[model samples]
Target chain A: MYTDLVAALDIGGTKIAGALVDGHGRILVRAQRPTPARENGDTVMRAVEEVLAELTASPLWGRASGVGIGSAGPVDASAGTVSPVNVPGWRDFPLVARVRAAAGNLPVELIGDGVAITAAEHWQGAARGHDNALCMVVSTGVGGGLVLGGRLHPGPTGNAGHIGHISVDLDGDLCPCGSHGCVERIASGPNIARRALENGWRPGADGDTSAAAVAAAARAGDPVAVASFERAAQALAAGIAATATLVEIDIAVIGGGVGKAGDVLFEPLRKALSTYATLSFVRHLTVAPAQMGTDAGLVGAAAAALAKRTDAAAAGV
Target chain B: MYTDLVAALDIGGTKIAGALVDGHGRILVRAQRPTPARENGDTVMRAVEEVLAELTASPLWGRASGVGIGSAGPVDASAGTVSPVNVPGWRDFPLVARVRAAAGNLPVELIGDGVAITAAEHWQGAARGHDNALCMVVSTGVGGGLVLGGRLHPGPTGNAGHIGHISVDLDGDLCPCGSHGCVERIASGPNIARRALENGWRPGADGDTSAAAVAAAARAGDPVAVASFERAAQALAAGIAATATLVEIDIAVIGGGVGKAGDVLFEPLRKALSTYATLSFVRHLTVAPAQMGTDAGLVGAAAAALAKRTDAAAAGV
Candidate 1:
């Protein structure tokens, strides 16, 4: 099984990425296309088709045994459909069927992008050796997935580890997801920037008001910037602690733009964790930066495909 | 294995209960003793031994094939130890080893009391037939267990579903467990009574200030009493919602004293669930009163023993 290759797609609101990946997790062929996200579902499917066409043009395409998709979600893995919050036009899109058809009717595996990243981390990155882990993307919108008891826990809907939307503060700020005090509302990249600006932190002459700007200011000893990151860290700590308590995860891997803030985020995050992760079994949990880079989604999709194929073969399918 | 009986024990800070349970989960024989919790660990073990001695003396004892124990936790099944918070006399006590020795070297299984209840719920109670569920006991202190993918998720240390201590309000009041705004601190029976009293709700001439008294007051239209239950309901809803969001549980079964508050708790809890459980997959989650009664711990311990023996036999161990 490890000698075979899989065709993988990482579909997001911004782009469609496809790769032919060997079982070793190395991409042997790659292609990309801008997503027509605002267009109708068919148009968005066309862009994905174009990416698949490019991948199929490669000589390595013939060697691929299955197709795997990691898509921005509300994915219904049971129904083989997706409705990404960021891709309104693709609501309830029949993604698995489309990908399977485009990939020469090969067996297809579909999972939410968060779960995909978790698969990648568990297979070859930060969570590689851990039997239970949480891998998160603390970006414009916080998202995450779980690896429980050494398997990808995508759940029935491929959306089990949607940590970003879980309320850490029952009485805190309202989130766009219609919940109040969600982890993403406090800890995402935009939230970090918003809190900093709300607290009277100003950007430099560059006029960049992103979380990165706040990170730079915090590094230069700006009190307001530091406080904002600490607040975000606090919310993240509580959410992570709650997750660990519920599921017994041993490690939390943080990625995305905000996570890359380095000490500005990690230092405060480590400090706040001690306050919330108080249980005897959970007290030993550690947080680390995610080692998977931008290609994580594609690699993770490939991993899921390989896993499915292996399971199918074992079942004598 | 359904033709064989098993020995089951439920050990708490207050009592040691033992039973010779048949394969059908019926308690054919029972024994119990008050726990000398304030005494040394050896003294506490004596009470357990006495209970076991009574069980061993039963006419049906020879039919028991295995033993299972559910103890007040922080229990480490991997290390065969327990250090229950309320039982200060036994920290890291070798409970499994002690039980194994006392049970004539028969195969033994151990799990946290919460997990035991969950096993009961999953096996034959409200969560029956559900592939994923959270079963909770909302009594003097909130405790819970999980059944994921059709099996009891006791986790590596037999303490997976210790939901009572997970903080829902990260910045709220400090919990005795060293965290803040834990579900237990807000929604447990004692907390309900304490909060009702703190908010100027008084007891009647009989001087009963228990949560059951508060429940009676709420039923009789006492606004302060109603509000106290509402607050507890809100915290419970948040915690349940968080659990559903993280693990994709389809239902949450509530048992124990506060759960017996009936509509006074359930009505508000059902209403509050919608406010926090707004995610796509989790929005459909339901809450119900647990069907298993006072003997859930014993029945669940028996279930665990049966399951262990079955698995061991399958593995040819």
Candidate 2:
């Protein structure tokens, strides 16, 4: 069934991404442009329009029925607006209207970047076939979304999966949200590098070693690297396992940049899960890595569009 | 809306309960009998039957069209069987079929007792109007149910909400589930009393002061009692906060025997929540006492019958 394609956009701090996605979670035509960070919301929308125009061609665009944009944090999906904490210019901006204006307003859907990834995972990735699970992006700022009892929670303010803000340690570190000991305070990419630098494990700006490098070094038997990954994993896993005790999902899907630590992260993460979530049933909680890689946001946006179709069909009002 | 009344039964180790409930979440009649633990499953069923028979004299019984049961842990809600860890003679016993047979072919529905309470809370109590929440029983066991995105997760075996088993401290305590540091082992009623007695709080049967007594004494300003409650709250709040971070629910319904500590529990619970859940959003999670109280099981069971009716109507196939 040709349910019409959706132009999925991922608006990041550094990049503007747009993709034409069909109902089956496939990315057809894609466009990428640099994001103008310092510019106001209007300028940002202009850049988004340029990227969309390049993909639409006004011909292929006819085949697409709507637009879906996954933006950064503190979003209000219900209002179709965003108050991104990272992009200072985007305070209560009407991003969905702008994207709709750029794409000729077939229908516009917006979600937290985290929620988009969660939808992507549920639709056709590591979290497939699971109704209750957490889709977590452990990247620049840890965030997540939940598919609980087989439904997505857009939350009252669309901030349901803000995992990075959850504080595991009381006196550990401070986060951008003015919280102390948040997982993001100590486990985000920059935090990992800083921790490494503080411990004399990071080689420096010239080294430019990522969390992935720490994972590699940990694998190579580097004690400090091992310790860094373990510390971050400890915080992340504690939070995850604690959640398992309450929400009781069968699995957790990890994605985003920091998730690339792979086994270095998963192994220790599992160990931590076992340690923190010692419940009989919860001990069996499985941790899986996302399979969709970088295209998750786009695929997830398409899934959002598909969900709208399903909801509308279900209502039949 | 006179869909038919449901005879809902709850069989705990300490109590046997029966209630007649209509589709609108109203309990028309209620009765209780002490559980004869030394007797086998057959004897227990006879006791349950006796209680049900007592309730049948009520006017609502004539309208009762079905039965719903919520049994102790390790139950198979789908199969309507239970082998409660504390109750003997229940090894794979088909509680639903037996209860149905006793009820004379009444449509029988089965759910984890915890899930049953969760259903009740979601329908009429703390979790009402919330799409995602948890129903937790901090009584004889640390049992719970997940109402994620507004659906109850019975798991494959219907034993999904076993929150007490979630390990809060790896080196904390030994649980019957063979895992270390389960919240149950650390914070459940028995453990609370056990630890308090072990710590030389009150002179009595060690583990006998009861979680209730601890709450009372704590409320009355006993240092030992205060400490015990704090420890339990600390563990429980951490678990609750972690769960909020994962599911991002608006409320959690806490019920069962031990939840009566009231502010004694809620105060320390909040303190621990704010301490362990550093994330601003999760730290804002709400906790409420279960509204249905002891009848929550019956209420939830009747809700299940109501759900069955709604489903049958919707299908019309």
Candidate 3:
């Protein structure tokens, strides 16, 4: 049984989330602070320290062993540096070392938030008990992590489960990754909205409507809305089926805000799988909505620290 | 340095290969014997014992510490039982315990041949140094092993790299595994030859024809032969490109007798990849021929044993 507490941190585009979690994967104390955007590494480090200090000051932080930080894209966990594409300020940031510096000299574990989300699913959510599966979040931007063969697959660059970048439409739109027809470009929220807007489906006749609103309209008999979401769902499912085929993943966990579309998204996606499900081994592959909701990153960060503590105890290191 | 040696065995439909390999991943002696048709598990075990004894009697077998066997499909590695579909008379055969008994108490390891081949590729083949790739042998039946994110992936049933079974066409063809549109069912060796034979094409006008003969005929201006091979190539390429998109594999190595179609296959396969690569990730993927040739299986068997022995040694068991 787990007997120690861990420091879990989530680094986002504009904020940092920190929490002290018990061995049973429970959050004891939590703190959140804005990231020092456009600032140098020292400023960002100070922000993270402040966030961790806030949690450490809590009486619940007693006996905590180490820290785990989850950051955004293009991260390198092997080197414990974050190279988030959206936050250029974090290019090659020595995140683990920085967290360790303020963590009373305990070990620091850094991983991609997507990877953390996947691990969280493995440790506490939909992907539990399945050695090979994917946790895909289709929100502001699509991000995912892979749990393959009972182990997390954080690539040499810590970008193993970058499914959004997978191509589903060769002649589709261009993606931010400089690729044409990426799943993200053709299926993410922005793409969905862009397609809807272009096809004359106005959100409040052009308001701040999200993909959820579009899904609602689709269900309410809006043809353009249905068309856009269906198209996105089709693209995502094709990519998912392809992943399932290649990795032999038994299940796919879809998270993020867009997943609330539920059947509106899943039905078309399943149909796409049916179209591509000729392979007996890969057919009838399951896709489900993620269970941990917005807290997946937090749960995953805790899991990473918990894993290190577990490993250390096992190794007697 | 290799302080221990393990006898490695590979059981395939066509051949049963055995090798005496040291712990350092080097093979000291290697030999092969054909697998008899409809040979039951008991008979195969007898052949296996003979092969092991021949190797153990050799000078290279002096240091072998254990035995490891990698066999064809539907095998239960955990229980050491084989239920290979291609090799009849093996109904839940206790292959592991049988091999262990034959080894006279040597530590035993059993896994899928795909896993072994992938392990071999990781240890010292085309996939070496590259963490995310797939090793495929497109012979009698298409089989594969996956190396994802710097580690080998063996699914819950130890069948993660069952790439050939992924459905490429829903209404395409029926596979032996009771699945329709499997990559293997559509594009594998027998299927390729069957397509050629069923197409009513003369193999270069009165030749004792096979797939290779048909390829020759196609090269020599047989319209039907060219179309048959092209269709097979296209299906295989679609499967390959789809895999690349999902797994982000940098390279895929094609082996087996069918791969002997050479440019006749690769050229059209690459063209299909170019045409059907929905994502840039897939489009840029590399497909190559396996470098280790027939030695791959034997080497993979060695690699599997190496992992087992090394893990045991590290565990201080």
The DockQ leader among the candidates is 1
The true-structure Cα RMSD of candidate 3 reads 5.5
Interface RMSD of candidate 3?
5.1
TM-score of each: 0.98, 0.86, 0.76
Of the pair 2 and 3, which is ahead by DockQ?
2
Order of models, best TM-score first: 1, 2, 3
Stretches > 4 Å off in candidate 1: A1-3, B1-3
List, residue by residue over B58-126, the lDDT tens digit for candidate 1.
888888889999999999988999998889999999988898899898888999999999999888899
The local lDDT score (0 to 100) that residue B123 gets in candidate 1 is 83
Candidate 2 displacement at residue A79 in angstroms: 3.1
What DockQ does each prediction reach against the true complex?
A: 0.80, 0.31, 0.21
| Residue A92, candidate 2: alpha-carbon lDDT | 83
lDDT of 3 by residue, B130-150 (tens): 878888878788888887767
Instruction: Quote model 1's TM-score.
Output: 0.98
TM-scores of chain A, one for each prediction: 0.98, 0.93, 0.94
lDDT of 1 by residue, A124-236 (tens): 89998899999999989999999988888888888889999888888989888888899999999999999899999999999999999999999999999999999999999
The TM-score of predicted model 2 comes to: 0.86
